[model samples]
Target: MGPKTYSWPVATFDPLILKQPRWILAIVVGVVITLAFVRLGFWQLDRLDERRVANTTSEARMSEPGRPREGVLGEHGQEVNEMLHRATSVEGAFRTADEFFSPGRVVSDRQGTLVATPLDLADGTVLIVVRGIVPPGTPGPPAAGFEPPSGSVALVGRIDDGEKPIPIGEHVPEDGHLASLSRVDLAYIDRWIEGDVLPITLILEEQTPPDPGGVPLRIPREELTEGSHLGYAIQWFSFAIIVAVGVAVLVYRAGTRAGPTEAFPDGASRL
Candidate 1:
């Protein structure tokens, strides 16, 4: 028998998109990646704006002197719009038994706690006043310096809405001790508290008698400077830009089937 022969055809690149590896999938993936990054970039910008507004409000409040408490907190309840962070003077007698301590606070560059005591006002209404800061780990029923003075006392502090407390089922405050708590919720605490308490709470600033025994009154920072937010925003935008550039490069490579340029890589092309 004559020698048998076998032949195989040479392989060549096809300029047909359909034949290409997951060409449709590639386009979809590219669009998704690009859009996701774009969304993140926009989110950062929004957060940056919020931070600026908050800081401005704080600075404005700090610049002014104390306002009158009655004017800010009328009989109808706290004038919500004008009371937050408004420094004011209040006169009342301390209800020591009703005093509760908010543990975990920082003062004078040191760890401490807050004295949340009720004050019996002249109008027979009770007001929640954060007496002042005391070293943390102090048991309930505050000691001398941290306690409010007996008899009539006029003190100054910034009126603020107490923080919201943990929801009813989530938190159970320890008896004779208030620890591991989050905020000073008026509605929640009012249930167990006595007397007609004011809606807003006072951050102890100054008292007529011996000093408050607390460091000078000042705002505790709740949010970080915008500089950090700005930095993060820039990073998000950078990521988006990178994703866009990568998509462009991929599309270009896929379209040009030749070493540098040809056409879309798909089905076979006619000569």
Candidate 2:
């Protein structure tokens, strides 16, 4: 009845279980993962190159003088993306009462409204003219006695392709009064103006001074930056490399290990 000693069984690890077959499988998986990562990295690099080319082309086009041309109004559909920031001259009388104001356009630390007016060409077809940006909170025509150009005047502006109309709530009118128009819908404007309108819209580059309000027409500078696709691609590739390396290390260790040894009791000695 000295001390009641209890002995517990010890567990042994079998290194042979991780044999050549298992090591081979691990190497194969590791190589596959590494290849996948390398492919992803190259794909990211390709996309970066494409973006660089596009940015360079756009900047070069913007720096040159815009093209100015005159043609028959409202003849057929025309693609406007090619003429963006390019100069175009139009001779038509500005429709005063029909001027539409687009609010909430914030650019270059200045908030203002984009003014859109229908230009009645000599041939009776209408051209939508964007008369440039005016300062926010400016009193519109009726409120400040604003008066548009009288007779047919020369106009020059950048061509902007129309986009889909912004969705409105139920409280907003669908057809009647013009409120804060978020997007430019050329088809809707054509129907509203009741004529064959030009597919391209002009952003007015020059205009007369505002009537009573202190609003001045201006253009905001746009700042561009490189996107994060390259960074994401690098991360994905790095992950794949890590996975491959981890598997390789495991396989290498397994290949170099020795067989397992039996365990003995605490008091036992090697004989």
Candidate 3:
């Protein structure tokens, strides 16, 4: 038999290969990518607005005067409006004998216990007052007994809501007398007092005697982080835009590399 011959055509770039399908895909991809970037930019703008509003609300509350002492303790709505650093005054006597200790509190890089005492207000309502911090290694109940300010003392303090309880099996003291559990369970306080207790709590700021028991009252400091959300929002949107653009560029390149010759492999040549 005669030698079999095979001829393979040399590949050549055809500018006409840029057809309707390629143009369509390019337009669709470009539009989609552009839309994605625009959406992300708007999302960041929205987050910036939200953060601004939050900051304004917080500032307004902080700048406003403290709630009136007469109806403040029993009022639930007032607690939500209270901001850190806002001061409140109360006329009350501390329940020294019935004092409780909150363990595992850290202040100024030193581990300490927060002293909580039920303040019996002049009107017979009980409000939980976090008097001050006691140094670590001090026994749960000081041997000399906890001493609050002397008779009918007036106190100015910052408002605080209750805290969540520590997990079960945590190393909270079980002894009911010397120390109670880790959490300030308000319900338990109410039951113990046998009266309607205020939902709000206080961190003592100023007292009649500046130095009560030689321990100066510690006021809480507020830490604020500004523009954090706007930064995060920008990051998320930037990532989305990068992803969309990358996909579009890859699709456009692939389409451009494919020529019209492949559109029909077996059809006869048309000049």
Leading candidate by lDDT: 1
In order of TM-score, best first, we have 1, 3, 2
TM-score of 2: 0.63
Give lDDT tens digits, candidate 1, residues 1-271.
Answer: 6444433333344457545668767767877887787777678788889878877786677567876777655632546645676678888888877777666777657776666778889888888877656666665555445555677888888777888666563266557333334467777666657768778888776777744553323435344367666677778778778877887676666665434333433443424
Instruction: Please give, for residues 1-271, the per-residue lDDT of candidate 2 as tens digits.
Output: 5443435443444456466686667777778888888888888888888878766765765576645445322322354555554555667777766677677776666777767778888777777876656667756631133445567677766666666776672234476654445666777776566567877777666654333343346554234445776897889788887988798667555555444455555666544
TM-score of each model, paired residue for residue: 0.74, 0.63, 0.66
Q: Backbone collision count in every prediction?
A: 6, 1, 0
Q: What count of clashes does model 3 give?
A: 0
Model 3 worst lDDT run, 10 consecutive residues? 258-267
Q: Whole-model lDDT for model 2 versus the true structure?
A: 0.64
The lDDT of model 3 is 0.63
Q: Compose the digit string of candidate 3's lDDT tens values, residues 168-249.
A: 7234334444355477766556655544578777778777754355562363645444666567667767766776677656
lDDT, model 1: 0.67
Error of 3 at 81 (Å): 3.4
* Candidate 1 colliding pairs: 15-266, 16-265, 16-266, 16-267, 17-265, 17-266
